[model samples]
Target: MRILQKYLKGGISSHRYKQYIICSLLALFMVGGVCGEYFTNCSSLQPGQYLCTEVNIDPRTQQPRGCTKEGWAKVLCTSAPGIICTETNNGTFEREIPCKYTNGYSYETALLLSVFLGMFGVDRIYLGYYAVGLAKFCTLGFLFLGQLIDIILIATQTVGPADGSHYVISYYGAGIEVIRMDNMTYRMPQEDWGVVGRGIKEL
Candidate 1:
């Protein structure tokens, strides 16, 4: 009874510390599962590799699975076992690629274009919103109010590809198994951090 009391009052572990640790880890995992987004670039990946964005940094090593960040805007990604790297003219290379998609239509791309050319409706046209692009172009982004709205939308991710497909930012590594998302707003299918797959949206 005294041991029980101590456990309840947090006075002693009574071998319960392991259980406490496990519960804490479970809670952390749950939180991590819900907050699923990570920022990365896909332009650095080889012609066919997709970006794997879901890799979590290990708390102990401060490293992600098969990935290392060498500098700002530079990530070195290593593939898992059984996949082979090849010699290339540029350097050593591996070429397990995913289905190609337009990299220029991604969220980051849209944000960039919107920042520079939204007033001219270039961003809208880029995302395949041709009619709206025309209107925005003629009206000068609805006198710039519409441009402001688009900026907010793209930043928030409430917008998506003009094809109405959802964009899912997932990590794709050479020789790694692919995980597909359904009913998403956009799909950024590459893994190199410099390139992105689709358009931006509000929220």
Candidate 2:
């Protein structure tokens, strides 16, 4: 009975630690000024598809004219002159992303990677914090200062450098395939043997 009790207690402790780790990561992402729910999370466009039509609105007649991906053009709005509906993610251009997030990068992996690498500022570097990342690594994590801050920020979901004004990536691979939202046109993904492009189902 004593042995069983000890085993149960250990299991409980492990579970608690797991939860704590998850909470910490989300916190860091939030602090990074990259907390976006609309564009970041699963893309709004479908895979293997592209917008073919363009929409235009008539201010005088209070009508909308637009085109669809099927090469069929139509009005911008029906009766609602002030409202217009146009495709947000046209899925015309492809994007390139690291093959790790959904495939393997999990809460546990993130925790371990950020902690050990923060000492060398490796995580920051991935986010394009080249100078800071280099400085932190050189300072040995600011004598552990950098590591501590990284932990807190990471826990609070605040460890990002912003993906820019366009293509907000809010969620992982969920609603849409490998999302690639960008205001400007982008070339098709053809790196590492055409693994990345238009939309990746699982690559």
TM-score of each: 0.34, 0.30
lDDT of 2 by residue, 1-203 (tens): 55346556784476666676688778877666455322321223343322423334333212222222232334221211121233333222222221212211233333465687888987767555688789988998899888888877655555533331111132332212334568776888657645555347564
lDDT of each: 0.57, 0.47
Write down the worst ten-residue block by lDDT for model 2.
Answer: 75-84
- Model 1 Cα lDDT, one tens digit per residue, 1-203: 66557787999775786687678777887666543322223334443344343344433323333332221222334433223334322222332222223223455578888888999898889888999999999999999999999999877767766875333333332212235677865677767543333322321
Candidate that scores best on TM-score = 1
